[model samples]
Target: MYVYDEYDQRIIEDRVKQYRDQTRRYLAGELSEEEFRPLRLQNGLYVQRYAPMLRVCVPYGLMSSRQLRKMAHIARQYDKGYAHISTRQNVQFNWPALEEVPDILAELAEVQMHAIQTSGNCIRNVTTDQFAGVAPDEVIDPRPWCEIVRQWATFHPEFAYLPRKFKIAINGAQSDRAAIEVHDIGLEPVQNAAGELGFRVLVGGGLGRTPIVGAFINEYLPWQHLLTYLEAILRVYNRYGRRDNKYKARIKILVKALTPAVFAEKVNAEWAHLKDGPSTLTVDEVHRVADHFVDPAYQALQDQSALLAEQQAEHPGFARWMARNVNGHKKPGYAAVTLSLKATGYAPGDITDKQLDAVAELADRFSFGEVRSSHEQNLILADVEQTQLLALWNELRELGFATPNIGLLTDIICCPGGDFCSLANAKSIPVAEAIQRRFDDLDYLFDLGDIDLNISGCMNACGHHHVGHIGILGVDKKGEEFYQVSLGGSASRDASLGQILGPSFAQDDMPDVISKIINVFVEQRHADERFIDTFRRIGMAPFKERVYAANH
Candidate 1:
């Protein structure tokens, strides 16, 4: 919830005007498609399969109710009546007219938002946990550091056009909800034995054609040198990262080619020049950035477990939702709630303008006028009072937001495949819908327990298929759509890429294939074992055998 200063506001306004002119020239035929490609990409406009898609940045996934309302307005006025939340916590309008994108950005700027750095081969949006400040087990609030990094990365002259797109993630909580292991740079805040704060830095982590769990480069990088160290890493990558081939241009490939030790050595050598330079963070500046995220006025209250238990007894449906959607809060009587966007038959992350407006109202009523977007393509109200849980649940249920499937099989994380993305080999939305229909029984999904089923249209891995407990990727063979399955991948603290399960299957067989995988998991699992735990305990052999036995 960082508010823009006068200077920030001016920069956004100026960029909007520049883009407006750029758009006018492009539409008037003064600029060809070749000439306009980079310019349009820098502003988050992509010419997709059917139309132009505009990706609007939601930095660190934070948005005010006012900002949410403006986004709803843009969706209603400028494009289709809906928008899709991406895996990086950004929002995408898949049907924006090429000429009208500037107007959409101009509207966004009025609410202190923009599409800057949402796309192209530059440092994209800095992301973190959806429950950054409010998580009960947090070691530090990451939003301040994320904002500091965002400011430093925005339009940094040297990194404006890297060898490839770059992503960074920061996690300050005990758990790794931010998926730090799968980003170009992952920072975890930690305190030393001497009681000084610093970060555990990981580098060379990414997911694409070549998926990797990042390697640890520094055990404890001091707090003051965060930006300086980052600059050092970028300097090394920009100098040595491949430009000949886009596939191998990412820092991960460079790190692999040089080995992590040599990569660290290069970064260390580069850091020697800039460690104490002007880019180093100061205590006052840190406080200045942090001031924007000051805690809300919270009333003192005892725990509401007894009252919640009574409500659970009164309403079974509410009880199921409470179990799935509600999370423990740092405050005594407050909780964080996830509003499920995966209503059956709809796209996993698609939200209509009407639902957006309703969510804005709900945020104001229960969460201090702020809302959060999660990497799992769900919306979060991070500071709802526990006493008002029943009322909030009732309202969300009426809005079709209470599906009680936060981490279950039905709560799928999928990308808009061939439907919107030109890069996709097959349509992911229909695949997700088919799976949802197959597993519609709430009892069945809850029985499956804490499964992350991610589907990506192609190997770009927009849906993060590499890290799902059950990962599904679409493939094109002989110009026909087919699905590939993988198992045991995770994006948590113990991160690992999934292992593929033999050959691809026809699209029509996807539902039964998933059911077969689940059947194997159920047969082999120990008591109370989650899908991931069972998969890990008993490798991929059993699941692979069961999945491909008849076909072979």
Candidate 2:
């Protein structure tokens, strides 16, 4: 929601011009593939298996309805008729022509959007909780801080190329919906015993070939030193992170090698040089950025619990949807609705141009002309009035947006695996579809309760399979695709990497594999326990036994 000033506009426009020239040079053979690789990546263009993919950043997952319409236009005009929402809350067009990416970037610039830092080994798009300002349990609005970081990191010369990609996440709420511990840098607002506002910083947490939860590098970093401290962390990583091996180039590997204590000490020494630097945050600047994210015009109204109860009794289907898809809001008589994108038979997160346009209209009508992209690959209307919930539900259902499976077993988080991504060794979309079809019964899913079933085509962890309650990773066995399953992983406050069950299974066996795992949970779970809690209580032994027993 932060409007671009003249400086911001000029910079984006200039970059678009520069990339257009670069693209022209490459297409004309003035630049070879080797030379154009980094340039194209820097601009968020990737030459995938069949065609080029363009990833457009949605900073902090917030998009005005106008911006949404622009994105839909791009999807319709430039490439395929649909786009995929990424796990990081960005959007990806999988079939864009390589020659037309600059035009697309220029179009994005018109709406204060760009693909900068969406790829490349620079700080990627800064992310936060989708319900940042409206969450009842929010301690502070993180959008301001996220925006500040986005501006600072965009095309920063000092960190243009790091050893590998860097990610930063901020959580300002009691719940850790932002998956802070899995990021390269995680910032959580905390208050000292003296009641001073500051951040609790975590460093070097990541999921890939090697998964590690971040260590607390600083117990408390003052608000004024946020930028300065961040600079120090990046400086240390840039100087010491490995470059000899791409697999081990991430900051997490460096942190592990140096030991967390030594890494913390090194960062502190680096911070000594940056302390009181010009990059130090000022109270005025923080206030200025925060002002842009203030609450919209909200009408005063009583809570609509009685009316909602009546509607629920009247329409059981709507009641089921309301129970799963609707979330509590900080404002009275309002709700945050998650429009499920994981419908059966469709790839999770894939939204057509028509769907995007309709969503934009819905956002204008109900959500203060803004929409949010959730990390779970769903669209959010964060300010829907409770009085209009029934009407909105009906409209969404008609548009194929109301699956009523948010947080259920069927609301899977997945990536465009082998179908689009060359890095993927196996297909992810079909696996997700198979599982969704097998578990289509609404009553059965509700009984299963809040299970995060995430799938990744490969170990890059784009699907965040490492954090799912039931994690599935694709493996290539003798040039054939096999699926490996894991359990007990979570991305919440109690973050932990999933443990593998056993050997991999053929693609066709995934559904049965998942069914066995679920059977174990249902048999062993205590009253009111979710899949994650049951996994933690009983460990992976029972589930492993059930899955492997069938294979044997």
Could you say which candidate leads in lDDT? 1
Residue 46 lDDT, candidate 1, scale 0-100: 91
Mind sharing the TM-score for model 1? 0.99
How many backbone clashes can be found in candidate 2?
Answer: 0
Query: Tens-digit lDDT track for model 2 on 1-552?
Result: 899999999999999999999999998999999999999999999888899999999999999999999989999999789999999999999999998899999999999999988898999999999999999999999999999998889888999999999999999899999999999999999999999999999998999899998888898999999999999999999999999999999999999999989999999999999999999998899999998998999999789999999999999999999999999999999999999999999999999999999999999999999999989999999999999999999999999999999999989999899999999999999999999999999999999999999999999999999999999999999999999998989999868999998899999999998999899999999997999999999988888888888455
Error of 2 at 132 (Å): 0.5
Candidate 2 lDDT (Cα, 0 to 1): 0.94
TM-scores, all candidates, are 0.99, 0.99
Q: Clash number for every model?
A: 0, 0
Candidate 1 ranges with C-alpha deviation above 4 Å: none
Segments of candidate 2 deviating more than 4 angstroms: none
Residues 265-291, candidate 1: write the lDDT tens digits: 999999999999999999999999999
RMSD of each: 0.7, 0.7
